[model samples]
Each structure stands twice: as C-alpha cells, then as structure tokens.
Target: MTTSLKLKDLSKKEMLLAPGHRMCQGCGAAIVVKMVLLAIDKPVVACSPTGCLEVTTCISDYTAWKIPWIHSAFENAAATMAGVETMYRALKKRGKISQDISFVVFAGDGGTYDIGLQSLSGAMERGHDMLYICYDNGAYMNTGTQRSGATPFGASTTTSPAGSSVPGKMQHRKDITRIMAAHNIPYVAQASPSHHLDLMRKIQKAMSISGPKFINILSPCHRGWRSKSDDAIALSRLAVNTCYWPLFEMDNGKTQLTHTPKEKLPLKDFLRPQGRFAHLFRPENEWIIEQSQTQIDADWNAMIGAGAGASGVIEE
Candidate 1:
C-alpha cells in the first residue's frame, strides 16, 4: 500500500528531528529535516556533513536526531553514506541482518554543490541504495555566509559582496539537479519547504525506490539572506512562483514538472524580500535584474521544450 501523506497522520509520527537545536531562528533547513524524517516510513540511518544542520543538531553530548545518524566531514558525506550502505548490503547478503533500513545523506549547498560534488557524483555513479538530500540555502551560511556554487546570480555573499567593485556573484547558479539527472539515477527532484505536501511526497517516493535517489530542496537562511525570519516560507514559495526554483522531478530519465506557477511572478518579487539582492534595486544595477530575468525566461522555456512539463503539472 502507498504511504498516506495526510497531515494528521504525519503529525502522529515520532519526531525524528527534535526541536531545541541551535539552527538560526526560522532556518528552513530545520523544517526540511522535519519534513524528510517524518515522511519516511522505515527506520532510517541519516548522514549529515559538517554544516549548520550537523553542528546544530549533533552538539556536544546532546543529539536532536532520534534515528541512527552519522556525522561526516564537510566533503565526504556521500562517500561515507555509500560505505555504510555497502556494508549493510554486504551483511544482509550474509544473512547477518533481516530488517530493511533506509539510508539518507543530508547536506547543504556548500557541501553538495561545491565541496562534496565529487563524492556525491561517485555515490550516484556507483548506484548505492541511498537517498541524498541537499537543503540548498544558496550560500555557505553556516560559515560566515560565503559564496557557494549554488548561490544565485547577482546575490551578494561575504566573498561576493555587492559593492562598487562588483555586484554580488557574477556567474549564475550551478544546476546540480541536472548534473544528478545526467547520472541516470532512479530519482532526482527539486522541491521547497513551502510545499510541505509536495516535499513529503517526493521524500516518500525517493525512499521507495532503490539505488541512489537525490532530492534538492531550496532552503532559506534568515541571517544570510537578510530577510525576516518569519518570511522564510513566503520567500521559499516566491522562489517557485518566480521560476527561480521549479518543483520538478526526473524519474529514471524522464522529466516531470510537479508544480508550475499558475501565473509566473517576476523575479523581483523573489529578490525584493532578501537583502542579498538589495543592490539590484539601485538604478545603476537595474540592468542586472533585466539580465537575470531574461536568463530565467530562457531556462524555463527550455525546460518545457525538453519535456519538463510533458506529463502535465502535479499541482501544489
């Protein structure tokens, strides 16, 4: 039987990620963790690399995780999880273990898009039975908010400050979702915390499938983004509404748009709330907004042309 996602039922599940951690107030990563752990029906062993989520949840002598969790380095989360899963399979083959367990690796943008990219690619290439989740908050928010590969174009970071010399990051954000899809993994998806049901459904779907499954979720960092802590959900939803982050999945090799904006909002609506892009509002930098929008339009249309919306929308 398929796992039911009714909110009432989900709320009854034991909280795998307990509260009282040191995650920045209103950090979306915490919400992502809760949603992911709640959706899984089987016992899961999760691996989190050294980042905000890891440091905050697995503090000295105090752990917020209820399940078996592993703490990996900033650059080896995927590799570590791969080894764990490999051993489980090896032991099960020898009839040393009987219970079915799920393996998951959760990392941030810095760990997934840049630092851990090599390990992540290797894990997927090897076809390990594990689920990798990237809660992309754009920059390296955990460590002084440095610029990361996943940081959006023209968004200021510590390394790419919006100053007279330069205006935020000059290059566009790297598309890690497509990179993972290129591996022909069993599942690859991009979701957001604002769509709780959609995110939970995707998690459950990934857990059901064997082999490496990747889900890239857009999370919000209040301190880094200079936005109101309470605006995290609205900011996340604006990303989807602006087409900055589409809710889609690549099942096998086919792409499907899970949720498309009913009426696409302007990119400014997404950027206006965040201080990272505050400079873009200046008269001199107005052209940057134009360029960003043009690029976004092209990418969205290309996805449609490439069959992203071929199967129809999943509806948020």
Candidate 2:
C-alpha cells in the first residue's frame, strides 16, 4: 500500500463525507474524517458513537455521509463495528457478500478514553479486523465541554473550572495510544491534523494492516478550547513543536517516533494561545506553568529514550 497521494490526487477521488454538515468552523474532527476517508480506496462502513460527529453529520434522514454510516450509542461504537465486521466475515464465508468492505469506528475522546474503553479493549483483544479512530479534542466538547479522561492537566473545563479555589483539571491526560499499543495490535499511531501528509500516510498504513489498528488524533476544539476557529491547525502544529504531543507509532511490541521537532519550542508556545491554559499564564500561577513545562520535558525525554530523536525513528 505504497501511496504518494498528493493533494491534487485527493481532489480526483470521490469524497465519502459531503459538505454542508453542521460541524463548527475549522473543526479538526471533520477534517480527520475527510482525510481518513480520502486515504482509503475501499468501500467503507463507518460507525460513530454519540458525539459531535455523529450528531452533526446525522440529523433524522438528512445525512452528510455518502458512505454507509451507523450512529451507535456513546459506549458501544467499537463493539458495534466489531459485530458488523464479524457478520461481514460470516457473509463472505457463506458467499453472500463479495465486496471487501472496510469497517471503521470514529469516536470522541469521551467515548474512546472513558465510556467506550472497555468495548474498544474487548474488540482489540478479540483480534477484530477493524480500525478504531479516536478524535481527541481533550475534553468532552459535545456535552458542554466537560473534562474527560483525555483532558490535559491545568486546563479549564466546565467541570474543572479555573478560579480562586482550584486550577483547571489537575490530572494529566491519558496516554490512550500507549494503552492501545499494549494490546499488541498490529498498528497503533498518534497523529494530528497539522501534518496532513503524515496523518494520511499513517491512515494508509493502518488500512493496509489486517488486524486491529488504532490511531489517536489530537483534534483541537475551537469552542471548547476557547481558541480562534482558524487556529486549530496552528494549535496542533504548536502541540507537536513544543513536544506536548509527539507523533509516534507502535508496531508489535516496539515503539517508534514518527516525527520529532528539529528545535523543540518552549511549552508556552503551545499553552499560551488556548484559553484553557490561560490561567496558568497569570503571575501567581507561574508555578503551574513551570510544573507543566517540567512534565512536558519529562515526557519528551522518556519518548526520546524510547527512541524518538533527530532521525524520527525509534527501533525497539
């Protein structure tokens, strides 16, 4: 599955997700869906849990998805897709289904990290042939921007508000990609919309695999993060540059860093722009900023020790 898909080549492919859906301006999740769909050439069957993507794209008979799409509950997207894939396999064995249809589940971090973690684990453990994509926008952006398991530390949310009493969410975000990698699946990668080509290449690689594959994408939420609508891509890039989010993949039991910054930028470059971390920028909260930077540095060092560096290749 070696594909050098230029942007012009994507325009030539038919889009499975049509425009005019009710996604917010510059929604990273929407772009992820588009890019994923464009990367695959096979017939797709998409399953989405209860989240912004499901709600916005599917509204009572008027669907924006040109491909066959299913809207599942908040916690059963992976299970549902696994069931569908199982049935497809049965049909194919019985000579009823001829086409090689691919099954993909798109869920928010709330679904993947918290609500649907068990189901995702079950599907992966069962060795289901499917792709699970988690569009991680940090907090639960669909239902009032509440803090979820994926929300970063010192970030304000409705449930974890920044005020005189408390800082934002006190806990660090879950390393879901690592967790999934522990499943020993064939492919597990972390991606961001900022690097379109890298993301597309990972998606292609995931599609080429025959077993369970997972990709955790750091999708920025404009409304939830209190950032400009047009700044989603910029924020994503800063996330990579500051080493807040390092792009990597785990194959078998080995981990490899896919992209490493040439000259890593300061954590402030990524934190200062988003209002969620605005509280940390205060004079009194300088300690929080220091703590955050220390944590980032520690995580980056660990990732590099695990093999990410100038070459961006980590062989276990």
Candidate 3:
C-alpha cells in the first residue's frame, strides 16, 4: 500500500489541509498535517483530540479539513478512531461499503503521552486498523504552555518553571515511541517536519501496513519553546543533527535508524537557540548542561547499538 512518491512530484497534488486556518505562523504541527495528508491518496477520516490543531482547524461551523474529520474529547482521540475503524470493518464484512478508506487520529503530547495513553494503548493492543500520530511540541502549548509528560528535562514551562529554586522540568521525556513499539505493532516511527521527504516516506510505509501504526512527530512550538516563529524547521533540524531527536523507525520488531547525522553536533547547538533553555546556559547551571549531554549521548549510543544494520548517513 506504500506509494512511490518523490518530493518534486508532490507539488502537483491538491492540498487537503487548506490555508487561512487559525494556526500560528510557522506552526510545525500544521506543516506535519499537510505533509501527512499529501502522502495519502485514499479517502481519509481523521480524528483530532482537543488541542491547537482541533481548535484552529474547526472553529465554529467553519472547517479547514477537506476530508471527513472528527473532533473528539481531550483524552479519547484514539478511542474514537478505534470505534470508527471497528464499525468500518463490520460494514465492509457485511458488504455495505465498497470504497477504500483510511482512519487516522491526531493528538498532542498531552493527549498521547499522558491523558490519552490508556485509550491509545487499548486500541493498539486490540489491533485496530488505524494510524495514531502524536504531534509533540514538548508541552501543552494550546493550554497556556503547561508542561506535559513529553516535556524534556530542563525545559521551562508554566508548570515546571526555571528559577533560582528549580531548573525547569526535572524529569526526562517519556519515550512514547518505544512504549508503542512494545505493543508489537505493525509499524512505529519518530519523525519531524524538518526532514519533509523522510517524514513522507515514513508515513507511506506506515500506511502500507494493515494494523495499528504510530508515528510521533517532533513539532516545535514557537510560543511554548520561546523560539522564533520561523525557527520551527531550523530547530527541528538542529534536534536531529545533535542526536536529540534521531530519525528512526521500527518495522514489526526490527528497529532502524533512518537519517543519522554525519557529524553529530553538540547538544548545546540545539538548546542554546531556544529561550526556554536559556537559564541552563548560566555558569551556575553548567551541571545541567553536562547532565543533559550525558543523557543525549547515552540515548544516541543505545539507538545506534540497537539498530545495528540500519542504514543512515555515513561519514566520508
């Protein structure tokens, strides 16, 4: 079911997520949605949880989505999609529907990694034929920049503020991707809008599979991350280059590193640009930076070791 697509060829396709929606300038979630919709040629029924994407795209009676879309509760996007997919299967078996369709659910890190984790886990375990995508912007950006389970250690947020007393969020981000992989799903991957082609390819590959696929995309938040509006993609690129968010996928049970950095940059290169991490740059907070670097190095080494034969960028 995977389509053979090239970036150059995608320009001619009609856009599914239209412009003039209320998404902020340079919103990474919007970009991820556009790319995902473009990669799908079949009829799509999308379910979105209460988040920035849902609020902006479906304001009042006006909707920006060209396809059939549903706005679910704050913590049940996956559950709602599972019900729809189950009904679709029943109807198909009864010969009531003839056309092909795809089911996809979109949720923020707050919904995916925390509140909706039970619902998502249940659906995946039941082997639902649907795609669950987490557009993780680190924190709950739609709700006044509150910290979520996916917020990385030392990142400032309303709930986890940085000051002389405390240094931002004290816990590491939950590895939701690995958690999803543990279900033995057909497909699981982490992607970012910084690498458009790689994301498109991953989406295509995920869609080709039959049951329960998950893709967690690292979407940069302008307001929450205290980054420049235009720095979304740049920050994402820096994330990958620094091994802070290495691109990789798990097919069935085999893990693969998709786009490894040729020369892995220092973690500071990725963190120093964002105001949220500005406090960590102080001389007094040098230990926080060193600690973060140690964690990143450990993660990168573990990923490289796990994906032993996976293809990625090789040094010259």
Candidate 1: pairs in clash:
none
lDDT of each: 0.92, 0.89, 0.90
Q: 1-316, model 1: which lDDT tens digit per residue?
A: 5557888887777888887898989999999998898888888999999889999998899999999999989999999999999999999999999999999999999999999999999999999999999999999998889999999899999999999999889999999999999999999999999988889989998988999999999999989999998988999999999999988989998888888888999999999999999999999999999999999999899888887783455555
* lDDT per residue as tens, model 3, 1-316: 4545666678888899988799989899999999899998788999999999999999998899999999999889999999999999999999999988999998999999999999999999999999999999999999888999999889999999999789899999999999999999989999988888888888888888899999999999899999898999999999999989988999988888888787799999999989999999988887888998999999889887775444755321
What TM-score does structure 3 among the candidates reach? 0.97
Looking at model 1, residue 189 earns an lDDT score of 96
Per-model C-alpha RMSD:
1.1, 2.4, 1.7
Evaluate model 2: give its lDDT.
0.89
- Model 2: lowest-lDDT 10 consecutive positions: 307-316
Pick the winner on TM-score between candidates 1 and 3: 1
Off by over 4 Å in 1: 310-316
Off by over 4 Å in 3: 1-4, 312-316
Residue clash pairs of candidate 2: none
* Candidate 2 C-alpha RMSD relative to the actual structure: 2.4
